[model samples]
Structures are given as structure tokens and as C-alpha cells.
Target: MLGLFIAQVLNGLLDGTYYLLIALGLSLIFSLGGIINLAHGAFFAIGAYLALLITPYVGYFGALVAVPLIVAGLGMVTERTLFTRFYRIDPLYSLLLTFGIAMVIEQGLRWVFGASPQSYNIPDILRGQVFLGDFIYSRYRIFLIAVAAVAVAGLWLLLNRTSFGRIVRAGVQSPEIVGALGISLRPYLSIVAGIGIGLAGLAGVLLSPIYTIHPAMGAEIITLAFVVVVIGGLGSFWGVIIAAVLVGLTKGVLVAIGLSSWSTAAIFLLMFVVLLLRPRGLLGERILRFE
Candidate 1:
């Protein structure tokens, strides 16, 4: 039972890491772009599909490094051509546009790759398991934890320790002020979109090995990602992290207790509770919009 408990906790922590990656990007995009990108999941699907196509040529590590850039470039293009138009309009327009984009991407991928799910094998190096006393865990999972931790730390540094990051955060708070200060926030907005989409791509790459790659995969996880965002608050960075961990751990514990069926529902329930108690989210700041 102790071993089982330990294993569940480990699994929960890893699941939280996945949520963190997805939610972080969602938070960044919504906070900075002021648009709820319903197509964010499409970027995720693109990353996994791109990995499947390129991994054979460049290897897993190469695909990991390359796919995010490719996706980011695509994100920048989409932002400039399509998303930028709706920023000044009602956010509803952008939301609808993104929803359409998501549908298009999903259908396009399905047409190209067919409806069957694809699988990728973990690299030989990351295979096998490690023992911690009597508990054993997959090395790949440990690598996931490491990768997620590093990504989070790097993001924190970028946001808190760097000038560019400061500008982006400031832009999030006041775009007009940023522009008035002789800084063109337009470029930063594009970069923020690219970075946000790139993070989603990264999540897809990491998840490809564990989950089956399918067009619908992104749709499946995207709602949960939104739940994480709402629980964490719309624009709160640390809030997403905390909510993700809490949801992940709670789901893991529920599954361990033989209530696997209720894991997702448990997440929704938690979100509802958070909403009732703290409507602004755990770490969310003042209401940004007049909804």
C-alpha cells in the first residue's frame, strides 16, 4: 500500500507537470494577447504530427528542438495574418475565429494522416526503470519531471530576471503605456504569441510518447488545460502552476483509490469549488475584462 501510494504521488506529480506546460502557454497567450485561443490545441496536434514526421530524420532530441520553432513560426504567421485582426474587436470574435481554426486544423490533419492514432516509441536511452528503495519508476517519467522543472524555471527567469520578459509582462499589464514609452509592443505581442504556441508544441512533443498521437488528442486535453487555467486564474503565472499541481495530485490520488473514472470529473469539481470560493482564481489579479 505504501508503495502504491508513493507511485500514485509520483504519477500525480508528473501529470501536474503536463498540466503546467499546457496551462502556462494558455495563460501566457490569454494574458498577453487578450484573446482566448481556442485553436491552441491545434498547435499541440501539429507538434506531435511534426515530431512523427521529423523524428526519423533528426532523432527524438532533434525533433524536440526543431518542432517548437517550426510551430512558433507558424504561430507568428497566424497571429499576424489572422489573430491580429480580432484583437481590437470583441474578444468573442477572436474566440470564434480560434474555434474555427481548431476545427480546420483537426480536419486537415485527419485528412492527411487519416483517422487512425499513431504511436511513437521512447528513445532507447530513456527506457527502463529506476529504483528508489522499494519503489520503481520509469526513467522516461523522471526525465519528464526534469524537463518540466527546467522549463518552468526557465520561464520564471525569463519573466522575472530578463529585460525582454519584463517588457512582455508590462505589455500584458498596459500595452498603451508600453507603446507610449517609445517601445513598440506589436513586435512583443507577436513574440508572445509565438512563445505561447511554442510551449504548446513542446507539450505535444513530450506527450507524444505517452499518449497516442491523433487529431482529437489535442481536443481531449485542451478542455482540461482550460480548467487548469480557470483554476489558476486567467493571467496569473504562479496560479496556473499551483492549480495544475493540485489537480494532478487530486486526480492521481483518486485513480489510486480505484476511482479512476472520476479523475476528470474531480478536476471539474475542484474548479467549481475554486470558482465559488475565489472567483478571481488562486493567484489571478483584478478582473481584466468587463464581462
Candidate 2:
């Protein structure tokens, strides 16, 4: 039982990475753009589908590098063409617009990819299981964990240690100040949109082999990602990270105890409790008002 518990916990941690990546993007976009993006999941689905189409030509390694770029570019275009116009308008308009886009993308993918789930071939090198102490886990899962950690670490360094990151952080706080300083917030905000959407794409690519790749795959995870964002605090970077791990572990523990069906309910319950206890979220700082 102890070994099983440990194994499940590890599995939960692996699952947390997906939540982290998705929420990271959601949080970043909201922080920088003041636009609540409901179509973020569509970007994820697009990434997975793109990977499916491109992987044969480029192979898994090449697809990994190309898919995010493709999705990020798409996101940038969407921002430039659609989202940017809605920024100073009501947040509801942005939300409704993105929601519509998500539906359109989802239905389009369904028409193209069909209603069924597609199988993603796990690379031969990552197919086996490895023993970690007394518990054995899939090597692919461990690789996913490593990739998520690295991605999160890289993002942290980018936001904390670099000039662009500083601009992002400052812009998140006050775009007016950033503009007054002579830096056009447009490029930085666009980049944030790309990074945010790209992170979702990256998550889609990483989890494709493990989960059933389908047109509605983004819908499956987006709610949980939003829950992570709310529980972690809307624009709080570290808050999202902590909430992702917490929610993932909670679900893992329930599943390990033979309550898999209750996992989602449990997470929602936890979110409710957290909101009641700390409305701003675990690591959320003062909410920023975008001008």
C-alpha cells in the first residue's frame, strides 16, 4: 500500500505539470492583456492536431520544436487581428469572442479529425517503465515531469532575470507606466500571448501520447486549468504553480484510493474551500487594474 501510494503520488506530480503549463499561459495572458481568453484550449487542440500532421514528416523531436512555434504564431496573429481590438473594451466581449473562437476551432477540428480520438505513437525510446526505489513508473511520464520542470524554471528565469521579463512584469502591473517609459506595450503583450498560447501547445504535445488525442481534448482540460488559475490567484505566477500541484495531488490520492470518479468533484470541493478560506488565492498578490 505504501509503495502504491508513492507511485500514485508520483503520477499526480506528473499530472500537475499539465495543469501548470496550461494555467501558466492563462495567468500570463490575463496578467498582461486584461483579456480573459476562453479559446486558450482551442490553441492546445490545434497544437496536438498539428503535431499529428507534422510528426510523420519531422518525427517526435522535430514536432516538439515546431508545434509550439506554429501555435505561438497563430496566437500572435489572433491577438493582432482580434484580441487587441477588444482590450480596452469590456472583458466580457473578449471572453465571449474567445469562447466563440474556441467553439469554431473545436467544431472545425472535429469535422477534419472526425469525432473519434486519434492515437499518438509514443516514441520507442520512451515506451518502457523504470523502477524508482520500490515503485515502477512509465519513463515517458518522468520525461514529462522533467520537461514541465524545465519549462517552468525557464519561465521563472525569463520573468525574474531578464529585461524582457522585467518589462512583462512591469506591464502586468501598469501598462501606462511602461508606455510612459517609452516602451510600446504592444510587442511585449503580443509576445506574452505567444508564450501563453505556446505553453498550452507544448502541454498538448507532451500529453498527446499519454492521453487520447481528440478535437475536444482541450475542452477536457481547460476547466481544470481555469480552476488552477482561480485557486492559485488570477495573475499570480507562483500561485498557479502551487495550486496545480495541490489539485493534481488531491486527485491522485483519491484515484489511488479507488475513487477515480470522485476526482473532479474533490478538486472542485478543494477549490471551493480555498476560495472560502482565501479568496485571493494562495500566492496571489494585489489584483492589477489595466488601463
Candidate 3:
């Protein structure tokens, strides 16, 4: 039982890692651009499809590198062609535009790949089961944990330690102020969009082997990601990371103890409770109108 519990906890953390990557990117872009980015998930699907094309040729490790690059390029294009034009509009316009793009992307994927889930296998070296206390865990899950850790660390450094990160942080607080500083923010905005969608792509590649890779695979996760962002406090990047992992762990604990029904509602309930007591979310402040 002890070993089993440890293994389950590990699984939960591994799961949370993917959630963190996806939510972290989403939160950052939303903060900097004030765009809800509903099409972020479409980038995930694009990554999966890119991985599918390359995995057979370069294998899993190479697929990881190639998929993100391809999807990142696509994300850049999307930002320039679609998202950028909506920048001056209200936040609702951004939200609606992205949501519509997501619908189009999904339909395209369904048309090409059909409605069935596609199967992907982890590399041979990373395959098979490893034993811990006579309980076996898949090596792929362990790989996921490692990959997630590195990705999150890289993102942390990008957003907090680097000059680009400093610029991003400044823009997040106030885009116009950053713009007036004699810096062309359009380039930065495009780069941030690429990073955000690239992370989503990475999540798709990470989850491909574990979950059914279908046209609509991103929908459920997108909903959960939103809950995490809201509960973590929108416009706060690290808060999203912390809250996502906690929610992932909560789901694991709830389901492990036979409260499976609560697993679906767990984060939502937490959000509701948090908002009731703290309207600004866990890390946000209520925006007040000027007198």
C-alpha cells in the first residue's frame, strides 16, 4: 500500500507537470496581451499532428524538437494574421476570434485525421515497466516528469531571469507604458504568442502517448486550464503554475479515495469558494474604475 500510494502521487505530479506547461503559457500570453487565447488549444492539436508526421522519421526525441518548432512557427503566423489585428478591440473580441479559430482548426483536423483517436508509442529506450516495491510504473511517465521539470524551469528563467522576460513582465502590467518606452512591442508580442502556443504544443506531444489524440482532445484540458488560471489568479504566471499542480494533485487524491465524482468538480468548487471570499482570485486585485 505504501508503494502504491507513492506511485500514485508520482503519477499525479507527472500529470500536473503537463497541466502546468499548458496553463503557464496561457496565463503569460493572456496577461501580456489581454487575449483569452481560445485558439491556444488548436496549437496543441497542430503540435500533435506535427509530431505524428516527424515521429516516424526522426523518432520521439527528435519529434519533441521538431513538433514545437513547427507549431511555434504556425503560432507566429496566426498571431500576425489574426490575433494581431484584434489587439485594439475589446477583450471580448479577442476571446471570440480565438474561439472561432479553434472551431475551424478542430474541424480541419477532424477532416484530415477523422474522428478516431490516434495512437503514439514512446521510444523503445523509454518504454517498458520499472518496478518499485513490486509495483510497476511505466518509464514514459518518469520521462514525462523529467521533461516537465525542465520545461517549467526553462519557462521560469525566460519570464523572470532574462531581459526578454523583464520586457514581458513590464508589458503584462501595462502594454501602453511598455510601448511608450521607445521599444517596439509588436515583435515581443509575436514572440510571446509563439512561446505560449509552443508550450501548448509541447503539452500535446507529451500527452499523445497517454491520452487519445483526437481533434477534440484539447477541449477538456482547455476548460481545466481556464479553471486553473482563474483560481490561480489571472494575469499571474507563477500563480497559474502553482495552482495547476495543486489542482492536479487534488484530482489524484480525490479519485484515489473513491471520490471520483468530486474529481471533476474539485477545482471548480475551489474556484467558487476562493472567489466568494476573495473576489480578485488568489493572486489578483479587483480592477476599479476611476472616479
The candidate that achieves the highest lDDT relative to the unseen native structure: 2
Q: Write the per-residue lDDT of candidate 1 for residues 1-291, one digit (tens) a residue.
A: 978898889778768888688788888888887889889989999999999999999999999899989999999999899988988888889989999999999999999999999979898999999998877888988897788788889888998899999998888887788889999977887888898899889888888988899988889889989999999998898999999989999999999999999988999999999999999888987744423
**Runs of candidate 3 exceeding 4 Å displacement:** 1-7, 134-136, 285-291
Candidate ranking (lDDT, best to worst)? 2, 1, 3
Tens-place lDDT digits, model 3, residues 1-291 = 666666666666556676777787788777777778988877788788778878989988888887887777888888889889887778899899999999999999999989888888777788888787666778888888788788888988988899999998777666678779887788988998898898899888888887778899777678888878878887676677767777888787777777989987887888889779766667763332100
What lDDT does candidate 3 reach at residue 272?
89
Off by over 4 Å in 2: none
* Residue 105 lDDT (model 2): 96
For all candidates in order, the CA lDDT equals 0.89, 0.90, 0.80
Q: Report how far off residue 139 is in candidate 1 (Å).
A: 0.7
Clash pairs detected, candidate 2: none
For candidate 2, lDDT tens digit of each residue in 19-74?
Answer: 89989999999988888888999899999999999999999989888999999999
- TM-scores vs. true structure, each candidate: 0.96, 0.97, 0.92
